[model samples]
Target: MSKTLHHGLLLLRVLSEQPQGLTVSELADAISVHRTVAHRLVRTLEAHELCRRDHQRRIVLGTGLVSLAEPVQQDLRTLARPILDELAESTRATAHLLVRDGAARMRALMVVEPRGALVHVSFRPGQTHSIEQGSGGVAVLAHGPHREGERPEVSEARAKGYAVTTGEVIPAVTGISAAVPARDRTATASIGISVFEYTDLGQLGTTVAAAARSLGRLLD
Candidate 1:
């Protein structure tokens, strides 16, 4: 790709991470470009409505990006609804679908949740956490290249085709997860259910793995 286009895309990525946006100087430093070069790229993005300056004169992603993302998110929710609902019902736990961010920090993207019981563990949409923390994260990690310093449980999850963790992210809550196979070389994702300690985890892991397989098939 041309250097000019690469710089513009780089600016977009750096801006997306900063919810409060970034000053021109910050953007310049992030991209290893001079302030004038960053400004030129930002102007080109602004012309296409891909980026905008906020009231504080910090650069932010513009509404055009939201238009691009909303339809994709809606389609993903539609595809996962039946599988997530089934997983939640079968296990009597709150079911979730998490995707990897593919960023430097390996954040887990909270994509879907179907509540199981009258009282269920609720993680809000768009929530993110370190990919090393819980069962859902480990499940996705099992499908990818293992990195040094990763939790040892990922290996067991890879061996068993499922992962289970207790009170790791939330005290007294248990998480059972399975990796959803990728489609066309896309990023790997996971499906999980969070339940109380009393639930029969052995059975639930099997159920979750089945649901994950079904969801993975749908992804194709």
Candidate 2:
């Protein structure tokens, strides 16, 4: 990639991790670029409405990204809706579709609450967490080729066909997830459920894995 383009992308990524925004000097240090170069890149991003300066004079992601992201998110949500609804209803829990944001993090792309459940876990879509932190992320990691020093839970998930975690993303809650196989696509994602109490792990895991496979076939 062109050097300028590379730096620009890097700057955006750094800004993403810090939602409150960052000063140009902080952005330069974050991306390992000079202050002037960072400022220029930020200006270019501003021109495209990709990033903007806050009232605090800190650079932040622009609303333009919402326009760019919505269509793609909507397409994924549309495709996964029935599957997620079925999974949520069947499991009597809150089901979520999570996608890898990059190498190190996963983002909740969609969330569905069980229709008939009187009490179910609830969380907003668009939450992000480390790839090693929660069942959703670990399941995605399990689906990918093994890497040195990866969390042991990833390997365990690979062997078991799903991942399970407790109080990782939310205290006192249990999460189980299975990766949606990538097949021929670049997308990497997982389907999962969250419950307030621990229940049948094997049954839940199998159910989640089946849902993930079904979704994978659709993606294929």
Candidate 3:
């Protein structure tokens, strides 16, 4: 690879690991590059909006990377179409697939939404939510990281192999979800469904968990 391209990639890899981002000197030390060279590379990235300095003056990833990654979510949605359809049809509820945008961010973005019934719930793809709130988020967190004192909901999810919630993300709607395990240690994705009401919780949870396992295997 060209020297400048190699340096740019090195900086990106290093920044990808640092949640709070990094300073030019710290980045240089991490990549074993000179401060001047690191500064130049960072400037190039900043000009393209691939990287930018945050309020703390630390180098951080910018929206350019998000644009580049947008297609990845589309691809995931396509790959998950059949499974999502099966889930939506089985439950007769709006089925959704959510994935984390980046490794360090705890934000989960809705990547797919498959309609179930004519009166089913409606949700928008590309919507983002806290990874600790809804069933979809908890599903990802059940397999992802947690604070020192983890939440009871997440613990329950891990034990049950699925997460269920009511009025969490959307008031008056119940959600059932299971995590789509990733090969790596990242939070991985989640598949879920939303409904106005569910009479049989156990059966719904079982079906969602089964769909999640099948999706996980396909992803694997």
Work out the TM-score per prediction. 0.71, 0.74, 0.79
Q: Write the per-residue lDDT of candidate 2 for residues 98-126, one digit (tens) a residue.
A: 98765578899999999878899989988
lDDT of 2 at 144: 76
TM-score (C-alpha, index-matched) for candidate 1: 0.71
Model 1: residues >4 Å from true position, as ranges? 1-7, 10-36, 46-67, 101-119, 186-188, 198-200
Ranking by lDDT: 2, 3, 1
Clashing pairs in 1: none
In candidate 3, clashing pairs total: 0
What digit string (tens of lDDT, one per residue) describes model 3 on residues 37-108? Answer: 999999999999999999999998888988887797677666788888888888888888887655533343
Query: What clash pairs does model 3 have?
Result: none
**What C-alpha lDDT does candidate 1 achieve relative to the native structure?**
0.78
RMSD of 3: 3.4
Q: By TM-score, how accurate is candidate 3?
A: 0.79
Q: Counting only residues 3 or more apart in sequence or on different chains, how many pairs clash (N, Cα, C under 3 Å) in candidate 1?
A: 0
How many Å off is the CA of 94 in candidate 2? Answer: 1.4
Model 1, range 65-152, lDDT digits (tens) per residue? 7677668767766888888877777766788887665342233344344443666787766676667777878887777777787778
